[model samples]
Target: MPNVSKCQSLYSALVSRFQSENPSLVLSDTISSWLYQSIYSIYETSGEEEAERYVREAHMV
Candidate 1:
């Protein structure tokens, strides 16, 4: 969303996965917002490596 190249795959995977999980949400934009919030929170509190780990673990779950 903000041209953070490293976040591209994380954003795509999160948007796709969350949309599939919560069909009732009905808005990709909402999911994108949530994803950005989650990722930025993790990035701020934990750092990029942890954020990437979050994305990888999300795929597992």
Candidate 2:
């Protein structure tokens, strides 16, 4: 846990929450489309073209 910064942990927790909340939504074409929509949604909200460094790093876990 120490290796993960606070931001990384929080980001991961949010992602985990999505998965945990909808296990049925976590796979297949459904998830693919959701991920696509999410990509746009994230950028729309954050105005960022790419993921933050901590998000990229924490995703590896």
Relative to the true structure, how large is the alpha-carbon lDDT of every model? Answer: 0.70, 0.46
Residue-wise C-alpha lDDT for candidate 2, range 1-61, written one tens digit per residue = 1222433444555467566666664456775455445544554556342434323433312
lDDT of 1 at 52: 82
TM-score of each: 0.57, 0.37
Residue-level lDDT tens digits of model 1 in 1-61: 2336667667677767766877665545776687777877777777788888887677422
Candidate No. with top lDDT: 1
**lDDT, model 2, position 12:** 51
Tell me the lDDT of candidate 2. Answer: 0.46
Candidate topping TM-score = 1
Candidate 2's TM-score: 0.37
> Which regions of candidate 1 fall more than 4 Å away from where they truly are?
1-3, 16-27, 59-61
